[model samples]
Target: MDIPAPAPNGVQLHAPGVAALREAAVGLETAFLAEMLKSAGLGQHRESLGGGPGEGQFHSFLVRAQAEQIARSGGIGLAEILFQSLMEARK
Candidate 1:
C-alpha cells in the first residue's frame, strides 16, 4: 500500500490500498446501479441515474457503499494506513 509520489500530470498515484478502494468503488457502483434499476422497474436501465451527464445521488450512495467494501478488504487498518500517511505529510 505504498502511495506513489505525485506525478507530473498532477495525478498523484494512490497507495496500493487506494487502488483497491477505487476498484471497490467501481464494483459497488455497478451492483448498486443494477439494484436501483431493478427496484425502479425500469427493467433494463435508466436513461441516466440522475438526469443527464454527472448527476448521481445514486453514485454518491455507491461511493459510501464502497467504503464498506474497503473496510472489508483492508480491515480497520485501512484507516490507520491513511491516517499515518496524513500525519507523516503534515510533519
Candidate 2:
C-alpha cells in the first residue's frame, strides 16, 4: 500500500512512504476528534446569543479546526499509535 516517490539529486530513501502513512493516520485522528467534539456540543449555537442560520452553518468549520488543533497536539495519543502501527504493518 506504500508507494515511494522518485528521489532527486542522488538522494534516496529506503522508507519514503512513511510520510504519507503518517499523514493518513493523523487525518483519521482529526476526523475522529472532530466527530467527538461535535458530539460534545462544543460548537452548538445558542439562540439567546443571537446565533442563527449562518452561525449554525459555520460552527462546524470552527469545530473542525479546533479538532484539528487538538489532534495535532497529540490528541488522545491515537494518531501516534496509529502511525506506529501502520509503519510496522507496512514493514
On lDDT, the candidate that comes out on top is: 2
Per-residue lDDT over 1-91 for candidate 2, one digit per residue giving the tens place of the 0 to 100 score: 2322343334333568867776787788989999999999998998988866788899889989998888777788787778767766776
- In model 2, where do residues sit more than 4 Å from their true spots? 1-14
* Tens-digit lDDT string for candidate 1 (8-90): 23334453554554444445444554465456553333565446554443555554455445544553354444444543453
Q: Which window of 10 residues has the lowest lDDT sum in candidate 2?
A: 1-10
Off by over 4 Å in 1: 1-12, 44-91
The TM-scores, one per candidate, come to 0.32, 0.80
Model 2 lDDT, residue 20, Cα: 77
